[model samples]
Target: MRWNRIKRRNVLETGYDCLNGIPLISLRYAIIVAEVLNFHHAANVLGTTQSSVSTRIKGLENALGVLLFERRHRGVRLTEIGRHFVAEVSASIAQIDHAVRTAGAAIDGMEGHLSIGLHSPITAGFLADLRRQYRASYPMIKQSVLESRSSETIALVRGGQLDLAFVVGTVNASDCHSRLLWREPIVAALPLDHPLAKREAITWLDLAGETFLVQHGGTGPQVFERVIRRISERERVPRVHRCDVARDTLMGLVAAGDGITLTTETTTHVPFPGVVFRLIADESESARFSAVWSPHNRNPALLNMLDLATQMSGAASFMETSNT
Candidate 1:
């Protein structure tokens, strides 16, 4: 069974010759004849001879075993059955046309779906804005954002569970590639009434002996690790408490004067009522965000997203250089 044929050549085989050697053009001819109600006029509109159009319509009528036209003195007119046939065929042709367009767009990366993973909670700034811009530009493409821990995000990307991911720092995976997207300065998240909350900036030592609350995973724990790493190897480390709860819960504990926590400047965008974020005096303790993805992924939409990120990064660099 042949699906497509041109010049006596079978281009594709679908194991079903449903059309029975009939050209799809015959359907178009039938539709035009029904619209014009005149054989000569329909031929003129189709850029074919009148006899050709009439023959095509006759073939279609014979195939369907129905009388499609009722001859009249003025011109040809559609029979009651022909009108219903035309309506159904017209709807089917429109659907076929839409499917063709959608397939073409998918090949060009302008359509389809993408799943992206997020590790850090940068839901309010550049990352969020970038995703919004992507949606605005390609509304046909469906997107989902999966929130998870840093290591889990990287693992998902590497395992092909996610098309892309935005995670903290850099991920070291042979099967995955990562590029830094942006950075945020580490800030001390303290209770509004804490002593350091009044200062413009505070050092890591300022947090010493302060109940240091940490998230089990994510920005809060990353900050805790860095603070402890910065302390001298011989010096006794300050006591730290762990909070297996969410970031917002940890912030609430800080506000309750239960403990203090640290996060990047992005946390300020999140509305934590009793939490005040202050810059860390040591700038080296800043946080870096990166995008990680499986290098083997063949999704064209993923490629388009990566291209967009590159362009935006370049534009940001240019603006920063100009400002200086």
Candidate 2:
């Protein structure tokens, strides 16, 4: 990140007699001083002598006509005004870093950083493999993976906040490109002691009287609720227990005999004891995974991540077919 000090000062110099023998200096010097908060460290980072940094900072305060930092016995601390100035300056620095990286990528015929917005299920599976391989091949390109709900992720991609996203369900943003990754069928997870655990497959009606555990995230609970309503036609939907807050937590809860939960086949390798996964007998329900990217951002790093996702999906499909 690059730190930018305000180019134009807001200080109005009303009197030439206001100087109390303090010297003047640049905003760049003030920025370096604010960042390190220590005269020595700031001097080291700026490749200057500590005494020089101190002298320059004193000069900056003289010019600004306000104390930016409170000089402590050891190091320093920002005054309230200094804190606000630092916040804005730090953000500007980040933007400057991005601008520099973008320019460098252009010269080198590549793209800079790639930020991926992913839903919980996609983050757990397809994206995991993609991240590993993509980083290995393109170590120079930085990657950011954010996990959020499908709706929110889609909105981010549409607004240009995210470079790309892996989402569940359909992505309707016209400003971005989306590719189908896989279709996952929902399944029921039952405790080993449950009678339905022994069945080859269980239908929605089999859960009519059972206590259902709903995994909360994305639209998993909503989709499952719709499935339950269709099969169990009650005036009030069953108050299903919500046990797990995250994907892994939900799996742990399912294995602990909390209650039966619904999930996809892609999720496996549960560690807890006495848990059995049963395929849903019904075929009417399914969820689709997709890769969404902004059409405007031609970032090669983002495109490379998408390529990795495509490769992972292909490998998964081949594995499925071979197993079948």
Candidate 3:
């Protein structure tokens, strides 16, 4: 999508200028200039040079064919055209400020809906408590949760389809905002009476020839693939039996001695007959889970959800610490 072709009807209009043959500067810069009321200050605020600000203003004026400022001994003053422009700019700024304050208030007020997209591993334990508490605290606010792969969750959040998500593994996104929630090392899962299950901690080399079970898609598979690739250095990639199932089901399969799997220590709950989780001896490859969202979201409920997620992460940390 070309940014130059982007236009809005009732709010903004930018297209090929038939008169001055120059494109319009965005309202963002206009708001900055109006606030400072000085080219240098506006430039400084906008992280540009004074000359650049003057050039942009000139370009903007030429594009509209309207003089927006009157120079004086003290400083530049708004001309008739400038006065009219300032009013519109000021009104827009006021509306924006009002919207921001109102949004903040709504987040604090605990109103509106929050849509959450998260990978399956996170949804199993502490996150459930967070949903329960958040609902109890704010009965008025509506919440919807979607379980998906980390990549898909991040994409949805970035695209504005989801308000927030818990993502694992590396995030290649540059546009969306992210916060580190917690870091937990991936542990090796083995069935009861399994040879390696007796060990306190195991390494990739320890399971060199063992059959491995890995989640099918998203960060789970990616992480497993990385470990396998590294381990395949002196030997073939160990026989990996991939499974498409929820976290609990995966654990059940491991308990049933289907195959060993790697997952976060916090995700080591064994609801099935026999299962044991052993920490990985390697610390460098430890996985970190992050809470991510788009900064452009104006919804207050989403902000509250972020805070709630943080709290849940904290609780999970305490639980893990106690377990260890």
Which candidate gets the maximum TM-score versus the true structure?
A: 1
Q: Per-residue lDDT for 1-324 in model 1, tens only?
A: 111211122211222333567567777667777778898887887778989987877877888999989867767988889888888877766666567767889999899999999865646767877788888877888998888777787788878999999877766666677776677787878998988888988776676667678777766566667757765432657667877787777888989999887787766888888889888776574577777888788898998887787676653442211111
Candidate lDDT scores, in order, read 0.74, 0.66, 0.68
lDDT of 1: 0.74
Candidate 2 lDDT: 0.66
Ranking by lDDT: 1, 3, 2
Could you tell me which residue pairs clash in candidate 3?
none
Candidate 2 regions exceeding 4 Å error are 1-111, 121-125, 229-244, 252-258, 270-274, 308-324
How big is the RMSD of model 1?
6.3
For model 3, the local distance difference test gives 0.68
- Per residue, candidate 3 scores C-alpha lDDT tens digits across 1-324 of 111222222233333432235443445455566656787777776667888778767777777788887655654667787777767766654665556655666767566788888764443555666678888988878888888877788889888999888777445466777766666767777898799988999877887787787877755666577667757863766678777876778878888888887777666753456888888776466566666777677787777766776676764442221111
TM-score on alpha carbons, each prediction = 0.85, 0.52, 0.55
Ranking by TM-score: 1, 3, 2
Q: Clashing residue pairs in candidate 2, if any?
A: 2-93
Candidate achieving higher lDDT, 1 or 3: 1
